[model samples]
Target: MFAVTILGNNSAIPTLDRHPTAQVVTCNEQLLLVDCGEGTQLQITQYRIRRSKLRYIFISHLHGDHYFGLIGLINTLNLMGRTEPLSVYAPPELEQIIQLQLDCSGTILKFELSFVPLLPGYSGLILEDKDLRVSCFPTQHRISCFGFSIEMQKRKRKLIPEQAKAYEIPAAYFSKLQEGADYQRKDGSIIKNDWVTLSPGKAKRYVYCADTIYDVNLLPWLKDADMMYHETTYLHDLEDRAAERYHSTTVQAASLAAAAGVKKLLIGHFSSKYTELQPFLDESRPVFANTDIAEEGVSYIV
Candidate 1:
């Protein structure tokens, strides 16, 4: 059940048909909100996301399009009487920004809100829970920004029922076997766990290359990811403009995805000027066949 749902795919400005940059990553029962741009609360309601299960929020940068809706969403959650603690990870300045807004408005949240500051150029493991492990790396953006690498961990070994039955192992001990523990027979004979259970499958990863210009240094973080989300703010023809704005064009995004060997590529954060999205696909698919538009309200499984 590891998946990411696009909330607002547009960049900078909200269009009639598109909003700003926001996404929700579902890791088992928990939800991680990434980049709560303006109108994000409404988007969450529209998509019917379980707000109760949202435990973490990751903001890639301080751009208004990336985090302007944070205060509003926090207020909404407090008004809704949410009691669970919510952790937010972002740049150091964001803590003061959010605190100032809360203080001036005399708003007190009912839930415990904690902030973890991501220092400039810091890159390493940021979070690890039972279901997911998240790391962050610096991206080449206008301001200090970061990209998230999320890995879904498979902790339990796969049990071979036939092999277990052949070993005369009781079903009561199957759970233990799946936990990689040896089983002892009534005669005190040890049955190796590997004899009846296979190792857990490789972890699946989703890398979010948040708001970066085309930079190959990200290859180490993006390599071999199961799914990667990279912003294609403009068509290939706007490559120069994209460079000027510290953004990426469709061809550049596709080329990086191809070079990194990601299983699939989700491209979004479109410029408000683009009305028809087909040109983006038309320009990207030839360069990388596995690219898909990160359409709002659509869930992409990793």
Candidate 2:
């Protein structure tokens, strides 16, 4: 159930078919929105996403394309009678921005909202929940920016049914076995937990490189990800311009993904200059196979 749905993928502006940067990361039943670009609320509605289950949000930067829709989403949540608490992770200055917007509009939310600042000169694990763990790292962008790594932890241990049955363990106790509990017979004999259970399998990870210039320093964060989303704001031909503007090109993004040995790559945040995007694929697939365009409505399973 861990997947990421692309709500908006364009770089600097909205387009007829494309949108600015925003994504919904579904970790089982819980949802962590990565960014809230303009019109993100409508994008959620159009894609049939359940906004009610969103418990946390991570804004990568202060760019309007990254978080301009936060106020609108908060207002709408209040209108919908939401009572659950929501936490937002972003720079320290975002608190003042949100406060100003709410104060100026005389808007009061019906639910609790908290902010966790992603400060400069610091980067490490930021969140650990029942289903997922998230870490943040600084990225080289025009403004202060951070990238997120969402890893889905395996919950249940593998059950060896034959081993359990040989130990006379009852079927009703299997759930307990999966929870790493040993069995005890009526005769007061103990059946060891390891006799019937194995460790949970590997955890799957999804990394989002919000916006950045071409830099090899990101390899550590991108390493061994089950899937990764890196912005390809331009085609390979615009390499010079991309470097000057602090955006990445398709070839640069693909090279990093390939070097990191990620399982799959989802590239988006296309510059509005190019109306056609097929060239991005044509250029990136040479460097990394399994490269995909982050289309607005498609969900890429991590």
Candidate 3:
């Protein structure tokens, strides 16, 4: 169930067929909304995503295309009688912005809303829930933007039923054994936990490089990631424009993914000018064979 579903993939200006940046990261039953761009609420409904499952949101920057839908979505949630608390992680200024809107409209949310401010030039682990860990890092965007790294931890060890049965351990204790607990027989003998269970597998890592220019300093965060999402706002020929705008080109995104040795790469945040997206893949796959265009409404397994 660990996967990311793209809601909007287009950059700045959204069109009828494409939209601004927004995604839903599904970690089992929980959903983390990353970058709620314009039209995000509609996209969520159109994609049949469970809005009730949404627990937290991470906004990369204060750009209109990145978070213009926040106020609308929050208001809609209240109107729909949502009572569950929700947390939003974003730039410090967003807190004031959201509060002002709420005040002007005399809106009192039915749910508990809290905001966690992400300071500029900050990079560290920001969240840890049951089996999910999220960290943030700065990206070289026009404004103080950040990227997110999500790691899904394997909490339970692989249980060996045959080994447990051979030791005459009851099936009722299998849950505890998987949690790395030892079994004690009625005769007062103890069976080691390691004898019947194997260590958990490596954690699955997913890095979202929100928006950035071609920067090699990000290699450390992207290194060996199971999957990564990097914005390719332009084609290779427009590398100059991309640099001027502090955005990334298709070739640049793929090059970084290749250098970082990530298992897979998802490229999105395409500029409105580029109606055709296949060329992006053509430019990226040569550098990283696992590169994929982040298509709206498609879920990529992490």
lDDT on C-alpha atoms for all candidate structures: 0.96, 0.93, 0.95
The number of clashing residue pairs in each candidate reads: 0, 0, 0
Screening candidate 2 with a backbone cut-off below 3 angstroms (N, C-alpha, C), the clashing residue pairs are none
Better of 1 and 2 by TM-score: 1
Clashes of 1: 0
- Lowest lDDT 10-residue stretch of candidate 1: 101-110
TM-scores of the candidates are 0.98, 0.97, 0.98
| Candidate 2 per-residue lDDT over residues 166-236, each given as its tens digit | 99898999999999998889999999998899999899999999999998999999999999999999999
**What are the runs in model 2 whose C-alpha is more than 4 Å off?**
none
lDDT of 1 by residue, 142-210 (tens): 999999999998988999999999999989989999999999888999999999999999999999999
Could you tell me the lDDT of residue 8 within candidate 3?
94
Clash-forming residue pairs, model 1: none
Candidate 3 per-residue lDDT, tens place, 220-281, comes to 99999999999999999999999999999999999999999999999999999988999999
Worst 10 residues of 2 by lDDT: 117-126
- Model 3 lDDT, residue 67, Cα: 99
